[model samples]
Target: MKITTNMHEGRRTEMYACGAWNDMIITDYLEMAVTKTPQKTALVGYRVHAGDRSAMSYSELDRRITRMAAGLAALGVEKGDVVSCQLPNWWQMSALFLACVRIGAVCNPLMPIFREHEMQYMLAHAQSKVVVVPKIFRHFDHQAMLQGLRSELPDLKHVLVIDSDDEQSFEQVLLQRAWEEEVDTARLFAERRPSADEVVQLLYTSGTTGKPKGVMHTSNTLLSNIRPFSERQGLSATDIILMPSPLAHQLGFLYGLMLPVYLGATAILQDVWEPAFAARVVAEEGCTLTLGSTPFLADLVDIARDEREQQASLKTFISAGAPIPGALVEKAASVMQGTKVISAWGMTENGAVTTTRPEDPQTTAVHSDGVALPYMQVKIVDGEGHEQPAGEEGDLLVRGASQCVGYFRQPDMYQLDNEGWFATGDIARKDATGYIRITGRSKDVVIRGGENLPIADIENTLYKHPAIQAVALVGAPDERLGERLCAYVTLHDSSATLTLKDVTDYLVEQKFTRQYLPEYLEVLAALPRTPSGKIQKFKLRDMARDIFQGQASHA
Candidate 1:
């Protein structure tokens, strides 16, 4: 495929590459997988009693990807076009992603849970040409929602509906025979493939602003992370991958789909977050490698405890998005049997930066977030952007191949310091051995159960409510989710009071997703502040924790 760099239609490869992505692209890996292991179990999914329902071989997946690419071309999706997909971990998504790279279109995967509040900003900003959504996922009517959003997104020409009753059916259109008789599928596939350095993925991450930031990543940058991370854990084609995390999230996006293709392994998809189902999939599919948040590991441990013998063939479990405690690691080995629990740390811009290797001591995996991958560099920095000494608790910055070139539409937002370091906005410390430990986040966002809540956006939206005089959204400590959002609000009048129901209703009207709505509401007479008139968020966090846990609010 011809190279398309950054947020535009045409740019030189040198503009973004720095010096990578010359030899191959993402689809090349799938091509290699098919060539090397034509009959190998390439993809697997679902843990329904019916068995591992979604399973596909290497050649079978390749054929589907080819057809889907041609089908997308028939639907007016050209090179450099953005195809936005908001889907669950269905078997079709894998083919769709491969199809995008094959047809030279950018793959934009949005969270299935993203409501109009999140979708509107990203879709419009990206100027996506074609959008694919499930008819109904988890009781949400995405088909109707995208249809309603059409007027707002003028560039959105096609809205493909998955498993639906319509002329524009997702499966019927993308996976069926070539739709356009004039176009030859073979020639189209050969000519439309993208360069390895082209911006193949246009993903969105939560930002300080109400809107989401679109992060652009190339095939090389993404593979740089996956190739090393998987190799470090000794992943192979024989391994079965159980992907419990949502494919929309970066963790699942890299390891869930791309990593499997890279390994030529079978990937089992669990659409929903059900621990029992996840465990069942692992056992049935003989899943060996999986990566997700700490909560996932915790839930799986609980699920394993009920079993007399370990049925699952789990080898490595890399828990990320939060810290993994020592207690959980010891318990996992006993209950999960053969599974080795590891920890990882990274974000949307960089896929998997640091990960505890299979060789590291179990204790190191439990405490530290692990050493940086070969494709990247990690260092702690002070407020003035100077590199901090080892063991100094300061801001964490990472630079290297796995990092995204820039943010889509908002290139200015992708700022880097003089040394090419990108501030992670996370306060962390690197040990003398190069292992990093995350202390806290400087960004104003609440990462609940691995889903990032737009703290500033929610607070700003709530402030518009007439009854809310002052509002601060802070993450209160929680065992399961790591942290839960709590809204500390002061009413306009003494008689006016805000309840959880009141805040939920107000946020709902603002088009915020239910997941982002605060679970607890702390009504305060006045918000505590520093001497200089800045809001003391630390004080509010304490109050939120106190109120949420049924303790008395000191304020």
Candidate 2:
């Protein structure tokens, strides 16, 4: 099946004949760009600490990748070998990933913020042999964390450090061997190239519950999700993509690294998310597009509103992770001038399955995740696997080229039912126009007074408040209401002391139903978030359980 045309005239083209999944992987696109636009700027890294910037043209990046692949080969890395990376959005991370692909090694990218415990679990689960990381990031001493985990992780054979002042720096490896000295292992592993069905990465979901689950993806699965967005957004070599999302996260990997390079576009990478810094990068670098979480967008909007010329070159803002409030969407569109604010929905298991297209109507663009990408199928189904009628909300099940192969080492979680659909764990509804609106996570729905309450609705509503920095609503056990809404709020400014009355009064003003209003409010200095900036609601649930237990003891 092929995407025909946009509503506009003369915008049609036959889809590339590559298999649905094969087109999305970086290897195919990397080879294409190296041949076609070797001189184009493939990646640009902006350093915050030194105020120094660096860039690599496609030809240069390809050469460095070849050498790096050779370096890995020297270290005994082979096809299916897991090479874990804990670097930020630097050029080395991108180069290392391509090197892994060139040699058919599975790239296991971890957030730089991960400490000993998280690193141990990821390395052990993936059985990663080579771990590449930074010596220090922010205040976290990654070297110490690596040292602590190195003993227990028997499979870890090498530790490659980037941006380090220490002896094990990545630069040392390249300097020790010239490009001519290293063999091009890309050809040596040509026959072993990961097929469209083979796993390329073992991405761990933010362990909000139990231990983190490793979501496995093949080259085909990764590309299938990317191709649709590239086609939908009309991504091109002329566009400069700036991604504030962590490269470790699925969105960042697809949009920041793969999608931009897939289209031969320049990709601008930043190590961290700072609204002011992002604004400067977008404006100075002439970034045409960017994607980030709702909070990132909110912060950018606030920054743009305060500064007159912020994000002047940005043409598109892709918001995901959490609900994009209408106000933030409007603010982004207005500030960016001709920019479209697109709401996208997906998870670690599936790269963005649905997103608002460039030509979508404003209402649809603002409120919905838009239509499913080509080669992807989505359905709203009841608990028993029966499809629900249009305009009804149910568990969202998705199947497509981009769907993950399965969880690593967990075959039980990998098997699909006889029907072949993967349960997405999200509750969503499709309108008559085919736009999908995510209602809430299956676990996020609060059953209050025998009625289901959508947490997303309440959270989006709370986002409008001037003092509320972040809000998450979780269900707490209640004797009367079955389950009651317990709001965990983080204030924008600590000086602005708030109370339960302050929250209830604001909800009343917003016209939230009394039943939907939070029965208890816990004011926190900050919300616990994963490395990807997703709110750790499971932690809040634990806190709520403790609050209830303490109250019960007193009673």
Candidate 3:
């Protein structure tokens, strides 16, 4: 786990001394829960195989983590090693986090949607020693995919498959056998227990560049955000969290898994995002809270109205990754009578920086992404670094304990000023009371349904197509999803024509993730350009919006 650091040891010690970061790691909390509430249900995972719903109690989870950590150690995983897992919301993911903590290994969680194109670079860059994957997910053979990649990854020693019944499967190798019995337990703990300041998690996020940047987080930085956020949401030990967002993402990793462990509460995970299924789970599990994007809220509101037998105990819905449309907030209030829909704004670099409180006026969620949480600061500054007056949009900057340590293996990419403020590539305006409304992004990327699509990567791949002369990918307005990818293209030959299917097929041939293929294609004679020959993407965005609105109205 070689990675970059934003703060030196002196600065970190100073922050800790000032009480910005607590000394306890997540494992400390897990042990506390095991001692205090050993019989309480700690996790419930709705896995993809056979629609199985699995639950694990605190004591049982701790025992499995000990075994799994020993098993990993026996397989040559040492302190400061990088262990990557490309898994969905599952019991294995939770166990792996604890196991990594137990062994002082860095945990790198990859999104299940990433294929060979994305996986190869991330794993290779991180120099991951081992990787865990499902045998198959969403009809894709993950084990087979990793098998194909292993020859190229010299550092990737072990490939553990979760649901396989073979000799090398996760169940047979890590769970069934008690490896801890063979190892010196006292020596392992003495040698491997990680400190609060050590980097524990490496998560990849889309940026303006074609390659995704790996955001690094220690237990202290992550919990710094989670503690304040859970407090503001009125969460407690008795609350059960119903999480539908992918656990690999920061939103789910913090609130779904880590938050529950922090509070000694139960976490119910839904691997697939089906509105009806989620509503049913909430009713069955007595879920009191959840955090997701606008799309999940929209679907949940739609399904909750028609399902009469499902008794939803859901109290709070914290929406992030996209703006909560005002109309949707009103509609949610109408359908889901008792639930509070809160708007939150943050990125992978800093988790949950701003979120409207549950006690705030209901309409507050419609317009603001709330003020900064405790120990965090958010300010809007102009290009010249001067602070902007209230209500004026400028580059959004943040500095806090919750900010990530730095990007992994990319020291030059880490941008922080002398004052420790990291410039987030978002344009926003702050109100007099310190609420921020994100107006636009300065980064060249598109966020589709809370997942940020790699815009430069897609455009670069499309540029390789022989039939295309110029291409730009813009996000078109979507009602359910916040935006859909729209590819605007000009042909190399005026007589040649390209359709949406053609573009998608070419992208698939290039091994692009099919989920991100552009939904709309517009063939223009020439893309709008500045006099200096730069692509005028703002004009293209307006065009895409009008075209999509027009087509949607006709439909």
Expressed as tens digits, the lDDT of each residue in 287-321 for candidate 1 is 88888887888888888889725545888898888
When 1 and 3 are scored with TM-score, the better candidate is 3
In model 2, the number of clashes is: 2
- lDDT per residue for candidate 2 within 322-440, as digits (tens), equals 55667667776676565678878887888888888878765566678878888777999888878889899999988766777677777665656555678877899998867799876
Candidate order by decreasing lDDT: 3, 1, 2
Residue-level lDDT tens digits of model 3 in 1-555: 545576677668767887879788898999899999999999998864468898989999999999999999999998889999999899899889989988889999999998898899899988999999999888999999998888899999898999898865988888888898999876896689888888899999864576888899998899899888888888899999988898899999999989999999999998988877788788889899998999999998888778634535888999999888999999888888889999999999989999998889899999999999998999999989999999999999999889998998888898899888999999999999999999999988788899899999889989999999999999988877999999999999999989999999998887778878999999999999999999999999999999989989999
After best superposition, candidate 1 residue 380: deviation in angstroms?
A: 1.0
RMSD of each: 3.2, 12.0, 1.3
- Among residues 3 or more apart in sequence or in different chains, the pairs in candidate 1 whose N, CA or C atoms overlap within 3 Å are 1-193
What is the alpha-carbon lDDT for the whole of candidate 3?
0.90
lDDT of each: 0.82, 0.76, 0.90
lDDT of 1 at 423: 90
Minimal lDDT window, size 10, model 2: 1-10
